[model samples]
Target chain A: MVTKFRTTIAALAASTILATSAFAGELVINTDTSDPAPKAAFEQLIADFEAANPDITVKWNLFDHEGYKTSIRNFLTADAPDLANWYAGNRMLPYVNAGLFEDVSDVWEENGLNESLASAAGSMTIDGKKWGVPYTYYQWGVYYRKDIFEANGIEVPTNWDEFKAAGATLTEAGVTPITIGTKYLWTAGGVFDYLNLRTNGYDFHMALTKGEVEWTDPRVVDTMNNWKELIDAGFFLENHSSYSWQEALAPMVADDAAMYIMGNFAVAPLREAGLTDDQLGFFQFPVINPDVPLAEEAPTDTLHIPANASNKEDARKFLAFLATADVQTKINETLGQLPIHKDATVGDDKFLQAGYAMLSSTDGGIAQFFDRDAPAEMAKVGMEGFQEFMVKPDRLDAILARLEKTRQRVYK
Target chain B: MSASRASRFNQRSLAPVLFLAPAVLFFLFYVIFPIFQSIQISLYDWDGLGPKTYVGVDNYVELMDDEAFYTSLKNNVIWLVLYMLAIPAGLFIALFLNQTVFGMRLYKSLFFFPFVISQVVVGLVFTWFYDPSYGLLNVILGWFGMGPIAILGDETWVTYGIIFAGLWPQTAYCMILYITGLNAVDPEQIEAGRLDNAKGWKMLWYIILPQLKPATFIALVVTVIGALRSFDLVSIMTAGGPWGSSRVLAYYMYEKAFSEYGFRMGYGAAIAVVLFLIMMIYITFFLVKMYRDEKGL
Candidate 1:
């Protein structure tokens, strides 16, 4: 009786495998964003794709950020998704080197995504092969409370001395100059990158992330020292460590904090906190030294497919659909992120509008987010070094030396 | 007839093996095999998906010099040592409620409530409890004319604060176990100890504690394992932050394997192997005690 039951189960397993392989019917997609509106939009696109290709059915799996990372890693080692959403910068580099993601250069050309989002497409390409389409992109810069500035009679600064003077002005009025949460570590790095860009230039920033220059180098040392000076001046909120980026916004909303150096995604939260357009403002992170060449703010996001995808053709179609103006506009409207497609309609999201203007002005010089532009291993070490410097400003040399060692190990 | 009788003896012995087949298979497939696989993975350099490069002992060697690794190890030691205080603390509470009193059962249930709820809920509750502005702890501290202290933000206090939150449930669990043990304590032995003028701490140490050995053993086993397996509370509460001061070996291993950081599966497995070795030390002691008890039985 046991033998009969075992034989029946074996027969069923063989038949299921044979049926799935024979039909060429199933398409699986994985994504990280769990926002309801964006998820619903993606599902609608999936429905349209299924309708267009009667023989194919798309299986959608969406996971929140943390679980998405774990599930994607597990899936890559087992059954990979046909299409996946991933970060483009250093995040994709490890998987690309491991040959886990497919080389979709042909699809990039066939679908015209290369010409559509040339700058973003360039970042997605490594070693002259494009690995993914960029669905959305955004800029990072200073978002300050206009009401506080107005109340304090301070103008936005466009240079290093003026920025410091503004910090001084805000401090005199008993308002904290910047609200940041270094608990996550990345928030502190965002400030460091902006400072580095201002102090040296985008090229030097690129060089540091690429590990061509030691973090202990004079340029890096000067940048850290500048941040330490700001910190010593009591420029940041008191409870920065206990607050997340969102939580830090509370003091800003209450007019206790004056400015936040953040990306465009922070705009929605500002609006949700009841800040009007006139009450808020932004600026390109000031150029600290005039000798360093000026460049644009960061632009980065991702859209990619796996190498082991069973439905490669369907994945290409999905990439094309995502690159379309309609889909990009829908995503931008729902997510409050800038569309990679130039033709996509811009929403009333002021931060995203500012991002579009800033990005359009710089044609030749665009850098991805520091962490995204660099390898993940180095980014992790570098961010930790950033936090260490933030906490113990006097340990600048030690932190830089440790990061230099990590860069040496990682880059080699 | 002699040959047939020998075959019958073999068949009877095989029947007992068949009875234990399911349990043996389950343990092998789930618990035992995964441990061996983890050790095998530790020897390779794999990003989890691609071809694993054989890098024997390199991961372990690098881990030795890793500052974050050492910090995590030190933090785990602090957690284990501090977490053991729950046992004596629980015993005290158990004694307080051990007497015949009104609503004793209800009081015991309320005391055991923390153990019944999920750890995630406990973490969230404690996070609010320690919140600098709105938390109950800070509000109560304010009555003494004290300013709000950044419990989670301050690196020096973050790990200790998390351990305090952890003690909430751990003490409750130990209390319930001790209450059961207290009920089973021989009344005659207590009366004999009382007549000999043994009371208070002396009575507890010489008389009651010796009789509560089984409960104490179970409590220690659970506490040690709980301390080592403490990932969820730390993850939900601090995420090894306030400048990575709260990171334990378990949380750090998960972070290395699949966070925004590099997915160095082999490196992560090596960390797991270290954690396992640390755990095995306590597990060995527990097994020996159990073995001795079994022999005595």
Candidate 2:
């Protein structure tokens, strides 16, 4: 009886030692930034954060972007890290609603992030509380070949008529006007979002995405009709559905296509493809309706603390550090994206400057891209319908009707 | 006295039960338990991470009206039917390579190389080969003045493109199996058939193929299972794109469960239950055949 009692006491002591050592002063972070530049930037951020806090050690787990999406659900419930990388706005809604993400309003308040990070506050807020800290977001617009425009004697399009006229001139010159790949389907969403935002204004576009307005509404039909005009002109690269977004850039690089409507991320690839700044120019997606406000597409990436985190104090510290203007500027410089902190100064990169100006224009506030704005279920069907419409414009009615059915079912 | 002791121990021994405990426990926990659990989960409306509300067959009811479900079912049928062609094709290659010639062993290994690579690699290679602008297939067709065909982009052809990619490795696998079976063939029977003036197709059909029943059975069973579980190739090559025209049941179930398209876990479980039932039919058939064969042996 004495030996049994001794063994039990020994076992209890061993477990206590193990438990304390496992979690003491160790902050775990799970991130999904598979792209080389962003991954390097995050690694640097971690190094800086670690240097700033000598007492605390960080354990970083990096996941490939696609696999991370599926695994996040598993890890967030089973063995959540102290902090995780996620997105702002509707993408983070489900997690916030499920209480998987912790409320980090204290972090914001303690760091005085309200003024510096004010631009992204609206997106990160849920139920009158902040759920995450948005670090980076970039603008989407028309990137055109300036040399081609000059050679064709065409002016930069400011509105729908000029845009169509430019397309006609490019088509006559044997150049596809726009190069877009819809094989992965999200590229179609980019085009559809711009059209919907420009045609029906941001409120109606948000309403449609939120399923408050029917997809079959006449306003949506008007958007499709405008899109149909571009499709009918044969402006897009031929056999575009066969390529990914990167592959579609080949035509633009080769002067076979003159323009691409894409995010600011494409600037690096365009430069790598041997285009000079003089050759490439940026413009906002042309105004379809002059009276409508021009809301831009800006999908923000965020950092969040999981509700079940074991090291909440350290996680909050890291989030506060990440929200600083210096840290935000450094990271966004590496990422080639706009910083969320208002005081964070971007480098003299022309595209970054243009993106900052365009996104911050007084015409309208930012609208997250279609897939990010809508629930994922609705986005999948909506994007598929957009792709189908691009291929067969005559099927617009059928496609919109089908999307209406999915929206009703999903949002219900 | 020792003999009596040994007999008593044998009569009351728990050795056999203890020996089987680990494997039986694992089988129950990992395989048997999950199947029933999935069935239970399929009766609810759960989004994987949230509270489950029991909705009782509503997912299946919703699936009835889902056009994507019908598309997946049709594609699965196509996959199953076309996958069987691998067996005959493999046999043909095995016969062609089963000869006494210089470098014959190397030839056999070369023919078996595709099966050695992972299906994901094969899918990627075929995706590149079918690329419309800069693919080998299009390059070859260009010599004949034929234009490009976007096989993966066209809904009508995307399923066939993926299936063809899947069949490449599957056929190689069957070929290796048949070659092994041919190595164990009774040469005396072949000589006897030669003496009877049976050669070529006649000798192969009547004399040789009869000895390959076991190999044929294994090949058929694996091919059928592979066809039904053809998620990797479709996922890698096309991701059921061109408006989901190429989705098989397995891929569709995964999409419903884990994709960014909302985590409808209960709906996905229902789809999995349907796939399981379909696979169970073949499993029962295979087991019954094996049992009969065992009795015959």
Which candidate has the top score in TM-score? Answer: 2
Candidate 2 chain A, run of 10 with poorest lDDT: A13-22
B169 Cα displacement, candidate 2 (Å): 1.0
Tell me the TM-score of chain B in each candidate: 0.94, 0.95
Output the worst ten-in-a-row residue range by lDDT, candidate 1 chain A.
Answer: A14-23
What CAPRI-style quality would you assign to candidate 1? medium
TM-score of each: 0.92, 0.94
lDDT of each residue in A1-412, candidate 2, tens digit only: 2243235444654453122222878998888998988998899999999999999988888888987887677667656789899998889988998889999998888888888888889889989999989999998999999999999999999999999999999999999999999888899999999998899888987888889998888999999899999999998887777788999999899999999989999999999999999999999899989899888998899999999788999899999999999999999999989899888998679889998988877466688889888999999988888887887788888888889999889889
Residue-pair clashes per prediction, in order, are: 2, 0
In model 1, the runs with Cα more than 4 Å from the true position are A1-27, A43-58, B1-12
DockQ of every candidate: 0.55, 0.53
Q: Which ten residues in a row have the lowest lDDT in candidate 2 chain B?
A: B7-16
